[model samples]
Target chain A: MISFDLRIDRRGFSFDVSGQFDEGVTAVFGPSGAGKTTLLNCLAGSMRPDSGSIEIDGENVYSSADGIWVRPEKRRIGTVYQDGALFPHLSVRRNIDFGWKLVPAEQRRLDPLEIVELLGLSDLLERMPSELSGGERQRVAIARALAISPRLFLLDEPLASLDVARKGSILNYLKRVHDEFKIPMVYVSHSVTEVVSIASHAMLIRDGSVLGFDRPSALLLTAALDGSSVERFENILHGVVGESTDQLTTIEIDRISISTRHQNKNPGEKVVVSLGANQIILAPSEPNQLSARNVLKGRVKEIWSSNGKVFAEVDVGPEIIVELTESALNELGISVRSDVFLIFKSSSVDVFDA
Target chain B: MSSDASIIVLSFQIALVATGVTLPVGMLIAWLLARKQFHGKFALDVFVSLPLALPPVVVGYALLWLVGTHSWFGSLGESVFGSTLAFTWIAAALAAAVVSLPLVVRSFTAALAGVDPRLEVAARGLGSGSFRTFFTITLPLAYRGVIAGALLGFVRALSEFGATIVVAGNIPGRTQTIPAAIFTRISAGDSDAAWRLTIVSILLGVMALATHNWLLKLSSTVSRDSSEVG
Candidate 1:
């Protein structure tokens, strides 16, 4: 676990934040100038907090009261910056080894070759940072950070600078790294899509204060999937596989069973499912003989109206948020506390090992 | 050695020694001016550039006051070397270093400032301490500008006459550099020897300036390339 309670006032901005990030990826999401980078820097030992302390895995890294502060190098916190900040003077191999060599032999958790292979950097090892593309540079930067065997990994918008195509590829690499390393990471980004894609938990920040912190699904169901922002449609739901068939698999969340496309997971295996809010359809009653495979009944918990569209949350065992036009909502005449059917195709859900 | 040959060799030696001494000191001052924040920073900046604004003779006098025989440092020099610092080849090199140090510091400061401070921060983030970052990252990135500055200082020292004549005096085959020997030749009414020395001085100055300009060009190109990569 990593926790920090920091207060800082600098350059026309005041930030006060306190939170704990347990094992796994805890994404810090906020709009621009929302103290996201400042928070990350404070934890990384780059920005000094005016008051309070920081601890990683129960060890104090910074304490304003005791005048104790571990330097960035000794903090054992690895960082992957937005610009990929690879040493331009060094080759890819040398850049990765730069941190690897500094780690003492007894504490080294990763082999140099394994990281190179994991990040697909074996072919580019002899190339300089200048010769690589944006995605390639970020890959090398991640490899360099992992080589250090840090106690906590801090990533400050590692994909914010990449184009859409590169962003997709890099996100896949990040997922692979997340699965391989099992190291706790603090990822900061403005994109809800990126956050939902990798982060298991999400912390929402606005105007320098944390507005919300919880599992991404809960956070998204409340404030994000209101169709107010199209980006938040990517909501992650956690579940475990109940039964499997050739065409579909039954994943259970709480008391609900969600049928998704076959995801190569055996029964009783834990999984996380990604369901886009726009893909889900809501009905006033149970729809029979519909093309969609999965349909569950629940009461409308809440409804939000904006820009001629309606976003409703239906608590079908687990809350299923969906978006529809104002005309469709009026035609169905569904309101809060009204029983409704939540419907989506089996193939609409994307499942991954949790 | 011939009189002209001895003057040229002595000038080269004095220039070399001056450059070697100026490099580390100038870089330190440059780094301070470029990266550090302190209370007396503006005062130190003005003090470093003092020699550039003042006449070389005035700078030589200031050095004399600080290191001449009557001063404590001069007595200490006497105790250490069994001779006063003034009127020696060592004094000439010191005068050269003092006169050209401002140029070196200025060039170095400009170069060091051009480097992105974020790169150093990234280095520190990647487990390098401040000291290691200077040698491994900061120094390498800023080396081209530093080399150009050193070359500029070397040429300035090689051509220094006002400060050397005041502090070291004209002692042929011992303290007389190319510029000092030229002064002596002209004062002794040997116009032909003076003309020969003048030609050599112009040639050396042209070569030094060309080399310095070349280094500056190389630094710019390298900086552009590295920035592209970074």
Candidate 2:
């Protein structure tokens, strides 16, 4: 577990945050200027907090009252910045070996080649950072950070620079890293979909203060209702691959199966599917001959209005939030406890490694 | 003819020693000025830059006081070397180094500053301390600029005249560099010797400057390409 209560005052911005994050991926979600990066910097020991205490795995790394401060190198915390920040002069292999070689043999836990293989950077080992693509550079950065066997891994918007397709692939690699290594991570991002897809716990921060901390979906809902601008809502569902064909794959979520466009995943593999709340259409009865592949029977569990839109929480095995206009809600006579069928095309669901 | 060749060799020796002495010290000062904040930073910067603004003769006079057998350093030098340092070839090299240090520091400062500080931070995060990071990452990235800075310092040291004469004197075989030799030859009405040394000095200066400019351009390109990747 990692816990910190930090306060820092800049020229015009002040940050006061305190949270205890458990083992797993805990995301610090916020807007661009919301002090998410500042908080990460404090945790990584790059920036000192004006006053506070930070404890990692029951050891006090920082405590202002005790006058104790661990340097970044001694903290054993690995950090991956948004830009990768690889040494431009070193080859990819040398970059990964940099931190690994610094660790004492008795303390080293990870094999360097394993990290290279994990990030699929074998062929690029001889190439300099400038020779690699943006995605490849980021992968090398991740591999470099992982080579240190850091007790607490901190990433600040690692996917923010990648394109959408690249982001999805990198996110999959990140999930695999977490699952394989079991390193506790504090990931900072502004994307709700990323947090929902990867983070087991989420903290919503705004203007240097944490607005909420809970499960990713719940915090996002509260944040959205609290007037925080979530660009669009996405329903993230975790499931296992039930069956696969060349045309489609069926994902079983809490005993309810939903089909998505063909994925390369094998049967029984765990995956997370993301469908935009706005893409879901609601039908009062099971419609026949619908072109959409997914038609799940559900009942509205709750209804709320925010930012001139209506959000209906429907329990279709897993609770999913569907966005609709106020007029549509009234026209369909949708309310809490009303029976409805959620419809979405299989192509609309984005499947990612869980 | 032999005298002119000896003067050229002596000038190269003095300039090479000066550049060698100033390279490490100048890089240290540049790194400090570029990467650190301290109470006396401004004062230190001013002190380092004093040689650039003060007349070379004035700088030579200050050096004369500091090593003229009357000061603590002079006493130490006397005990260590069995002689006062002001009138020796070492004094000439010292004078050249002092006059050229500011140029080296200016170039090194710009070079070190051009490197991304974030890379250093990343190294530190990866378990390398500040000193290790400087050697492993910062130095390699800024080596081109460092070479350019050293070249610039070498050229400045080669052409050093007023200060070398004041401290080391115009000893033909010991302390007379090319510039001082040119002065001595002109004084003796040996225009041919003076003109020969002048041409050699110009050629050396142009060669060093051209290399410095090329290295600087290459360093800029490297940084630009890396920035695009980053």
Interface RMSD measured for model 1: 1.7
User: Per-chain TM-score of chain B, candidate 2?
Assistant: 0.97
Per-model TM-score of chain B: 0.94, 0.97
Q: Can you give the lDDT of residue B5 in candidate 2?
A: 81
lDDT, candidate 1, A1-354, per-residue tens: 888899987788889999998778998887788889999889988889899899998899999999989898788788999989888788999989887888889989989899899999999999988899999999999999899988888999998889866776787788888789888989998877667767878888777888788887567654553333335555567798988888888999989898887766688887777787788888888778988888989999999876655788888888877888888988999999999998899988876656
- iRMS (Å) per candidate: 1.7, 1.0
Clashing pairs in 2: none
> Tens-digit lDDT track for model 1 on B81-103?
89888888999999999999999
Worst 10 residues of 2 chain A by lDDT: A223-232
| Candidate DockQ scores, in order | 0.43, 0.72
Q: What fraction of the genuine interface contacts, i.e. the true contacts, does candidate 1 reproduce?
A: 0.51
Per-residue lDDT for A284-342 in model 2, tens only? Answer: 99999989999999989999897787889999989999988989888888889999999
Look at candidate 1 and tell me the lDDT of residue A353.
59
Worst 10 residues of 2 chain B by lDDT: B1-10
Q: lDDT for every model?
A: 0.85, 0.90
lDDT winner: 2
